[model samples]
Target chain A: MRKTKNSVSYNKWGYIFLIPFMTAFIIFQFIPLLNTIYNSFFENYLVGLNQVGPTFIGLDNYKSLISNGDLLIYTRNTLILWVMCFVPQIILSLTLAAWFSDASLKLKGTRFFKTVIYLPNLIMASAFSMLFFTLFSERGPINSILIQLGILSKPFVFFSSTIATRTLIAFMNCMMWFGNTTILLMAGMMGIDGSLFEAAQVDGATSTQVFFKVTLPLLRPILLYVMITSLIGGLQLFDVPQILTNGTGDPMRNTMTLIMFLNNHLYSKNYGMAGALSVMLFIITCILSLIIFKASGHDKRK
Target chain B: MENKKTKGMSVHARRTFSYIILVLVTILCLFWFYVLFINATRSNGELQSGFTFIPSTHLLENWKNLRAGTLPILSGLKNSLIISCSCVLFSVYFSTMTAYAIHAYDFKLKKFIYPFILAIMMIPTQVTALGFVKLVDAVSIFRDSPVPLIATTIAAPVTFFYMKQYMESTLPLSLIEAARIDGSNEFRTFNSIVLPLMKPAIAVQAIFTFVNNWNNYFVPALVLKSDDKQTLPILIARLRSADFLKFDMGQVYVMIAFSIFPVVIIYLFLSKYIVSGVALGAVKE
Candidate 1:
């Protein structure tokens, strides 16, 4: 009788503990996600001053997105940007992590380096974007330095062209976030047994040899995690581009990201198109995430 | 012994090379700050003249100009504090409760719920932006109020994920069982026995949740449209695009610095927690 009573009490307590989170989750995340998917099929109208009502429109929204040439450009740009950002970020983060993990370096101030490097990640995205704006503008610091050093005779408009703008943005993003990847890799490095390094040392391993063979191999899972997540995050890149371009995706809309395009539709009162774009971005992000996950063998590990 | 000496010299050379690389990275890390610092000290015209490494005397003047702006930066700071603190509180409260439930229970639905939270972690907030806005609009929570609970910095996914993961890993069921055997009620057991032991997790989650909320821009931007209700990021954006460039640039930097300052301070204090917190949240079984 007492055991039964205890079990019954346990279930009751479970419900109580779950009530707040479950309520918030349903209200905040789950319902909104479902509504977004549902709204993608409807034509939303602002009938009165503020009332938003949806008229069912089937797959017209998705059809419109496919037809819109700008959408295609946005998708292409997003793809290019992700590649530019993710690839270098992974390589540099791996290199930095491996370097830091070196026993011979006897790296003092690990904590200081970690904190300083992650500093950019902590700064508000808007702030970082603004900082970059000041640093990379036509008359900004970068151009001035290049000009003074005679690398260029005049101030080069960093954001003047499409490719230059995107490349600059990608480079800045890599700089800002490589620290985070480094930290994760560092954590993974810590988990590896030290005796393996000793064995490598005994085997007449050079620094490069130990790094390429031991460190890189051991850190593959962590690298994979960082790469996959960065890919996912990079695909959703909105704030930096949005703020940097002053919300227009300027320079002939060259840097317009997929999320920015979706946002544009939303602000333009085209909820259906926005929804469709969202779903497309979602699928792309998911596919990329899955590819990285599979390639990293995260699935096999589990 | 002679071979050992050569090996020692090679190690020394390697260390010197590594130190050079470290110094290079450290300088690169400080490069952005150096640029910002130089700009902050320069006059507007001087700033446009390209990146001079020299510091100017306009620092105090620019700060004074920033202070005298119409936007209440101090109030935005206060709002950020209130919002971030509340978010931490709510996240901790709910996450601990949910964690306790998942940790202690073996109900028919336990298996379903545990993985559900983990799966949701993979869903980025951008996917749910449109739906979240509509939900907030429907609720009309922020319609009449200056501080909208539904729209203003309240709803977050990563917080829930972090809390749930923390609870599962840290809150052992044995302690709860002991408390229950001693005739402690469920709430009492959680409050006295469980919550105390979960301090480390709480601290970790609190710092992360606070930082995320404090830096959050997109959702708050979509939901809270009122100028007064605007958070720091939105305010910064407004200042960025505002007319009166001469009057606004200094104020913009000040506001930018203002928004970044608190997070920087908090990060300094809680830098250690970030690694563990991220690990717990990101990697899962």
Candidate 2:
């Protein structure tokens, strides 16, 4: 009788507590999601003083986005920039994680190193981009230094060159995030059992071989998590490039990303195209997340 | 004897290599910040002329100019603080409460809510941002108000997931049973007992949520249209594109520096918690 009463009271309390979160989730997130998909099917925009149709146009937004080829170009730009950053970021992170987590190394001042490295991650992306903009401008310190060092006869304009601009963006992103990636990877590394490394040593395996054979495979789950989150973040890469290029995505629009493309539509009050692009982004994120999961060979049952 | 000597030398060599790499990477991470601060002190003319590692005397003048400029920077700071703090409070408290509900009670929707949260975590906010803005605009109260920004974060799925993971390991049910036997009501027990017990998790989530909310530029930029309502980031962007001001680079640097100064201070104090908190989040997943 007591147990029955306790269970009943607890269940009542449970629902009462969940009410706030559920209300917000449904009203804010879930409803908005459905609304986005609904909006994608309708044409909505503004022309000077006139408001255009919220007219039902079945699949027309998607059709126009694909046919215009801007969608594909922006997607390519986003992916390329992501790859450029992720490759170096993962490599640097793995190396650092290896060194820091190695119990045998017993390296000193790691706390200091970790603290310093993670500082960039704390700064706002907009502020970081602004700093970069000042530092890399034609008459900025970097160009001035290059001239002084005789690396260039004159100041090299960073923004005008597509390669220089993209590289700077990639470099800035890698710096901001590699610390975070290192910390995550280190957590994965430290979780691995020590006996495996001991056994590898007993078999006369070098550190390199042991890392390849034991650590890499065991670290797969964390790596998969990192890759997917990074991919998602990369897809939403907006503020860095947005501020760096002053919302232009200039020098032949090579630096323009998917989010920037979406922002352009939203800026012009073209809700239909914005909705379509958002849906495309959603679908792309789901598909790519699945692909990375599959490629990582993770078992769901685990 | 020869083999022992060689092995010792190799170990020393490896340590040296590690230090070199770590120091070089550290320099890479912090070099730009050094330049930013250094330039913040120099005049626009001095800045354009050359780079200097040494500090200059123009910080106060730049600050004065920045204050005198059209940007409402002080207001931006206050707005950012209010929005981020409120959002952090709502996000952590409600997320904890929701997680507690799932962990402690044998409710009907127990299984459903957990997976539902995990699924929502996969959906990025940008994907739903258009609809969110439209809905906010449609509702008179929410339109142009920061309520939607602070309130929507109450359904923070990632924080919920983390709290659930924490509760599983740290929060035992026997304690709740004991509280029940003591004739304590549910809300009282949660407020007095569970909250104190969950401090470490709460602290970690609070910092992450605060920083994320503070650094957020997208939704706030889109939602807050008025100059006074805008946050520091939007103001900085305005200051950046303020072409009519003769593009005062010194003032620009000062503004950017000021924008990040509080975050840098917070980071300096809580970096250990922040770094370890990150690792903890990743490992539990």
Q: lDDT (0-100) at residue A1 of candidate 2?
A: 100
Candidate 1, B1-285: lDDT as tens digits: 998898889888977776687678778877877777767777676766666788888877877877687776666676667777887787776677777787777677778987887677778888888887777677765452334443322334456566666666677677777877799988898888888888887888788777777877777778767656667887777766665345534455555667777787788778877765655554543
Candidate RMSDs in Å, in order, are 3.1, 1.7
Top lDDT: which candidate number? 2
lDDT of 1 by residue, A76-115 (tens): 8887888898788777777777767777778788778777
Badly placed stretches (over 4 Å) of model 1 are A45-53, A296-302, B1-6, B45-51, B70-72, B144-157, B164-170, B243-248, B275-285
Worst 10 residues of 2 chain A by lDDT: A293-302
- Estimate how well candidate 2 is docked, as a DockQ score: 0.80
Off by over 4 Å in 2: A298-302
| CAPRI-style grade of the A/B interface in model 2 | medium
